[model samples]
Target: MFPTLDIQQPRPFDLVGSTILIAGNAAGFEGTLSITVSEGHDEVTGIASVGSLGLRQFQASIYIPDATAFQLTRIFVTIADDTGNENGPSVVIPVLFGPRILAGYSGWQPYTVRAGDTLTGIAQSQYGNADFQPIADANQNTLANPDLIFPGQILRIPRNDI
Candidate 1:
């Protein structure tokens, strides 16, 4: 007898044309498992299966495509024995989409603070614009003095005009 299948992570993940990696584990009796993902009122988009050698654990990697911030509604994982008999339990995971910043602008560009690299200088070099305030804000005011940045402190460079 198996326990149940659970789909974890990516709860309400922002799906706007992005690939989301859904990962999780299972327990209690396993031979082979089939996984499926659907969007917007039970529309199946992807399916996959994993082979188990009498093991009680399973993991799956599912890629979702053409998803929007509003299309995803629910996710489900079904487990079955090698005889195609329904297993102990199946799991349904709810999905949500978060606010997307913008295309090609992840807002987490890394910057190594150099000997004298001011926020303004870094911004100018990275974004071709010398607007340091956005950088400071993005880094959570760690660049308050703009001239007090130390060596090896990573800063997130926000996309200009965003």
Candidate 2:
């Protein structure tokens, strides 16, 4: 039997656009590692070899096409140990679409950064402006650097998409 695997990247309902890194840990098995990111009719596999960390753990950084992020889609990750000698279940994550989910606020939306999040992404993607100058201004205090954003950090999205 395969030991339970823990996925550490692309949390559930995570938004996808640029190259997304898929990472996770699996122990007790040793040999090779294989990873796949699939959504609906499209799927991409690793052409390059997967690198092992220590023990049975491994990591792989993959790229999902930009077109996949244009609309709402379920992103799933699949891992195979030792070249499909055994495999783990795929869960819906790195999901596409939806600028941001309203966090029960009257005029603002709470957006937690997922795998790929940026001030420019919020502005252009959620608000439809690539410049995202308004977003930078809106989050002036926390958004000191427009180019860097990490998962789990909450950002208040202007209700007016400011």
Task: Kindly list the per-residue Cα lDDT of model 1 for residues 25-132, writing each as its tens digit.
Answer: 544334444554554454434433444443333454554443343343333333333344554455555432211222343335567788878777887888777877
Task: Judge candidate 1 at residue 42 and give its lDDT.
Answer: 48
lDDT of 2 by residue, 45-82 (tens): 65323334443445567665454332323456655554
Clashes (candidate 1): 1
lDDT for position 18 in model 2: 43
Which stretches in model 1 have alpha-carbon errors above 4 Å? 1-6, 10-17, 27-31, 39-42, 51-57, 68-88, 98-162
lDDT score at residue 129, model 2, on the 0-100 scale: 63
Model 2, CA-based lDDT: 0.53
lDDT, candidate 1, residue 68? 43
Off by over 4 Å in 2: 1-4, 27-30, 47-57, 66-72, 85-94, 97-162
| TM values, all candidates | 0.39, 0.45
* Error at 23, model 2, angstroms: 2.3
After superposition of all CA atoms, the RMSD between model 1 and the true structure is: 8.8
lDDT of each: 0.48, 0.53
